[model samples]
Target: MEIFMETPTAANGGNPGKKKRSWKKLLLWLFLLILLFSLVFHFTSSLLFRKTEAGHLKFITPTVAQFRHEIAVRGDISSSENQDIKCRVRSTGGVMITWVVDEGTEVKEGDTIAVLDNSTLIDSLDAQQIKVAQSEAEVKAAENNLLTAKIAKEEYENGSYKVNLQKLVSAQIKAKEERDRLAEYLQHSKILYEKGFVTQSQLEADIFSLKQAELTLRAAELDIYVLKEYTHNKQTNNYESDIKTADANLSSKKSVHLQNETKLKDIQQQIEYCTVKSPSDGKVLYVNETNRFGSSEFLVCQGAMVRERQTFLRLPNSNKLQVTADIHEGKISYVKVGQSVQVHTDATGDKIIQGTVIKVDENPQPTNHWMGNVKEYRVTIRLENPEGVLPGMTAETKILVEESQDEKLMIPTHSVFEHGGKYYCIEKKPDGTLTPITVELGHSNDKMVIVTSGGLTEKTQLVAAAFENRELISLPELAAGETSSPTIRPKNEEISGDFNGENSNSSSPQAGMKPDGEMGSDGPKFGAGEMGQNTGMPGEIPAGMNGMRPGGPRPGGLRPGGMRPGGPRPEMDKMEQNGEMSAGMGENGFPPGMDGMTPDGPKPGMGMRPGRPRP
Candidate 1:
């Protein structure tokens, strides 16, 4: 009984020592694991960040320097004072070409330079003459009608009434005579009755004859009264109306004749205008214009249909020369009137001509396809000495836009970027932390920009471009591949799933997937077919195929296991089975026979080997 009690006590003491030794061993292992992990991380980081152009962020040290700016513009020599000769004729009938002076003929004032066919105007003139003759005959007929009416009116007023009164007087005389004779005969008959020498019936007949003569006399006298009252008014009114009508007709006929005569005069004037004459004296230069297709054709020719008014001759004054420069719209703001300009021409042995900007067009010049849609303004430069410059010759002009020798702190234009309507730059400190810096920009040329205000010095270093900020080592570099591998997690640690089906709990069989889950990073998509992501074979909601999840756990209808409930997961890592690889994830890594393959990159025969993945 005494030995059993002592044994229990000794065993209990040995248990404490074992527990202490086991705790020590656990601590040593944990320490070793932590130290190994730290060493591996450092090594990998150092190896990955080799001094590549990409890895080495571009940093430029600003310097105090001077910047001079200029713009190059193309121009052509032209005359400041020019004269144009145009056709001048007013003819309804079109003008036909007869003869024209040859191009470049020296002309003086009043010298005939062209002529037109006058046959059409001549025919019109002959017709107008016939119309004038007809109008004159109508005028003569109207005058004769006026004379006849006047004569009739005069005869009724002067002679006809007097002659009727005389006839009535003579009838009265005849009646008195007849009455006397009858009275005498009746007296004689009464005497004869006493003596039975005459019969009573004969004396009665003589008295009746005398009475009829008296009635005839009375009627003739009444005719005189009727002519004085009713006949006078009626005849006068008719004569007056006839005379007025004749006058109006004669006026109308005369007007028609005058109009025809005026027309004939105009036609004659147009005929005289058929002969062209020079208004001024100058050297003539022929003009051949370029059409829309850039093909040159003669617009002014002998047989060409010349319009009523068209400029066909030009006289350019080359003595006082000038150049017309097309300044690009972007640089036009720098140019101003009265600014000095330098012009050079190939015809003048490239001699520089000093000039001044005489005018700057307000509106932009019209654009053509051949001009690349570049907007430009027409700037006229008046040259001081043209030397041997001629019209139509090409010239190059350099306008002094801006110049500075004040020693401004300038950097390359590519070094700065604007954000949120403010210019910004990335400044790198000695500790390798990129700090955002705000800067104000000033005048700039094609290459350099002036930094007006910023906390920058001559020795300050800044990123050359915005893309240099992304050149840093990112978390993607830590995972360093397109394919994902299964990594078991500790019991205490939990993973989260991303929208792209990456980084899930270790308990889940399909945990991590490829970043940006397409088919491959450097390989084909889905397969050689390059199938569309949305239509992965119709109504079958393929989980891992098209990222379509219908009554499924994740996208592409992938179950907790894989494409098939308990099959290989549809991930990049399982793309290859033994040595066979999916069509999308080619065994050689590249799509077969890719036409877009570049010479510097993978060629046609490049892909993965047996055990190694594609390099």
Candidate 2:
């Protein structure tokens, strides 16, 4: 019975083996469906959700604006030449406020702005004035003293002193003579006393007389010495005193004069400071005075005490407006004087004002580390029509530093890439493929570049910008030993032989020829017959043909004919012979020694056997 059950063929739904097989099939189908969906999603994403590595999607647009040109506009205003105002003193006691006139007030030259409190100055000046007066008086006194001293010296030398000196000298001589006489008398008295020629009393009396005489002479000599000493002391003291007095007086006078002059200058400066005037004819924009210990503008005030040299208000010249824009250092090389500029004020909408580049900064401004990694140069632009512009206005300026005109063949700068110092363009072929075409480039502004040569024409289509994350198709690989269908020929290249033949059939010779004939041999025939041929008849003269016979024709000689074996050989013969001619042969065998044939040379017709010359 178990065998017959034959595994009862496990009830279709209840058999675990059969059920497991079905479940496995279901799972496989689900996996396949999921895989298909995933593949579709990946393809769609690649096509739709494409972006550059920097998370940007790029696309190509027609470069309609091949060239950018601009014009600069600027405001007109006047500047003050007298920018600096000077005063005697700059800083003194605790930030003094010396208002001349109000900041924006108008005044003429020499007008005052403000005045310092000159109370102290005035008092000092008065004191100096008094001192000057006193010094003047002292100087006069000194002059009088000098005069008195001179008179005293002259009087002493010529009158009193001279007389006294003479008297003293005379007394000295008299005293000397008296002393000699006394000495002789004493010698004789001594002799008389020793010989006892008289009594003792008489000898003593004689000695006394000699002694008295000697004492008198000594007294006169002592008086002379005392008088001389007195006179010398007086003269020296008087001269020294006079010199001292004069020096003091002169010094005092000079000091007083200098002080007075300095005081006058101070007074004048104070008066000048009292009046205020406008430095320039500009409208005052701001007058702020909020001392908050910040920047300069914040520290200014209106009613607050404003010191000298402190900026109290700002007056911007709205008439003459200019924009100071910073250009990147990398692109500064293209900036030059006279370039056109388009300035976009932030306040204004998309409307742009025109301007011209007035100046380019020669040096770069200082940079701070906090700023992004970039270097910039300051460029000044003068607006061409600055109607409603103001100072300190922020603007974005686009400078057109270069330009090209009139339907020039231009290509994308990046499409014409360079490698190994050679420029190339990825030219599109008729088979929806690309070919690497070497190109010669010319002047380029910033984006589109000019193609000067290398078989590039206006109809030639090139890949400008490429899709991101897409592989580049190499021309050599795509060609695979097959030539590209579309051939790019430059505008100046000649048409193919097939096209030329077709053109020739459709056009007549006269129509195809230019007014001056085609270039090269197709040009107008200059000489007779074909080029490089000698086409002369039997003595038939050729017109404008040199080294040929002048007669109309000869019996059996060369002549000009409609057709000859070779073209005219004038040029060849002239070149070979180096321009030399026969000495004596003419149209009629005329001799070289003719009337008109001078020593120098013969004139053309004068030396010829006249027969209408050549044709």
Candidate 3:
């Protein structure tokens, strides 16, 4: 045509941008229709084919079986009788270990098991020796002094006292003789006067001499008396006192020497104790003990400080073996003395040693703070054949409580659940329906329990783990004194999104919405009215949404009923008051429709809700 063929752009419209926009609009409508169709199909499928809670449970058929009733416990193999080689040294601070025999080394009675650092003890011995020597010298000096004292006492008593008395007696005798001679002269003078041969003065002189002689005799007698009565007694007393003092001094010196000798002996004994020797013929076990924290101080290692009387090694009687195991309080009641046991020691490999329970503790073992209220009792087991077993080895013991001679109906312990003072088991009917039945249990071990009375047939199938689905199934009425309620929920309501149970729904007003109302027949209704109006069809902002607008306010500016830019939304407050925005609402407090949008922007699922960006 002059008709020059219209340009391809001109045939449709002058504006290519408008045509492209229309195509995009058509594509958007197509996508929305498909999404809506999928939603409807999904809802229809869910309603038609509902899942049953019992479908996930595993079922087991009850059968007659025989199983042993036993209590299994782990223990350590030890000796019934042991000679503890302990540190016998008496040191204020601990002694340092110099050398120690390797653990598990067999040795004879006289073999040295350990050696301590005796350098300090050696120094003490040397010092004690010096003290002994000093004490000995002092004792010798004391002995010499005592001898001198005794000799002085003896000389005073036997020689000096007697000699002095003899001298005094001789003087007294001489005075008496002088007195007698003077008296005779006086008598002669008187005779001469009478004969006129001498003058009167001479006679007077004789008389005076006689009187002086008499005085001298009197003095001599007094001296003799004084010597016998006073001087002799005093000398004897002094000698006796000297003897007593010497004896006392000698005794004190001897006591001091004895004390020093005792100290020297103690030091020597301590030095001997530094080298620990095996007391019997057995394997040596080093006492590497641990604390409450399970960490050891390596007490038997070289250079380690060993306390006085702390056990550093042990010599176990290999001929007599035993195991010490701890039984829990729940199972301890079933264990009794004389019960047979099978012990499997880690050291003896696969060998099973037969043993008998010898002792059962009446009281529980010391409780650990970290273990809570659990209590355990100690049990001693004497092994019958323990040839290959060694001390300090880990062993597992299985104590035979009882055995069933006849076959009985047995089920797993987990298959039974306690409801309200009664045990229950989920029984499957022939019509594919599951129902709860009361079960009377008898004896039980760790794994299986015997059903005493249940009226269940051999072909009856029961849930393997009834306790897991107890809350979901309809259970029988509570027993007479039971107060707990059965938490049976409707099938459709179980899928409703309340993380916490009924308590959370009742506590918050808004969260307790009727399931049918919140989730309509259409299945999870999502629209702009529930989210923000501006959130959908981007360009033109509509006003019916229940939250704050994404942009500032609508064109008319802020209204009295409108929420501020960053303030709380009035609709949100209403939702909170009505309990609609409670914890039952998803993880975030918003409605399910608004779950796709966040404060910052849209989440990964549906990007921008339909339209162009606003200018």
* Model 2 residue 331 distance off true place after TM-score fit, in angstroms: 4.2
lDDT of 1 by residue, 249-285 (tens): 8898889888988988888887887887777786665
Best by TM-score: 3
Q: Give the TM-score (vs. native) of candidate 1.
A: 0.49
Order the numbered candidates by TM-score, best leading.
3, 1, 2
Task: Tell how far residue 221 is off in model 2, in angstroms.
Answer: 3.6
The Cα RMSD of model 3 versus the native structure comes to 15.0
Residue 2 displacement (Å), model 3? 25
Model 3: residues with Cα > 4 Å off, grouped in runs: 1-63, 293-298, 412-441, 452-615
How does residue 505 of candidate 1 score in lDDT?
Answer: 28
**Candidate 1 segments whose C-alpha is farther than 4 A from its true place:** 1-72, 75-83, 90-97, 133-214, 285-298, 315-326, 344-355, 365-376, 380-395, 403-615
Clashes of each: 9, 43, 5
Candidate 3 Cα deviation (angstroms), residue 606: 54
Give the number of colliding residue pairs in candidate 3: 5
The most accurate candidate by lDDT is: 3
State the lDDT at 168 in candidate 3. Answer: 74
- Over 365-388, each residue of candidate 3 has an lDDT whose tens digit, in order, gives 876555434567899999999998
What's the TM-score of each model vs. the native? Answer: 0.49, 0.40, 0.66
In candidate 3, how many Å is residue 350 off? 3.6
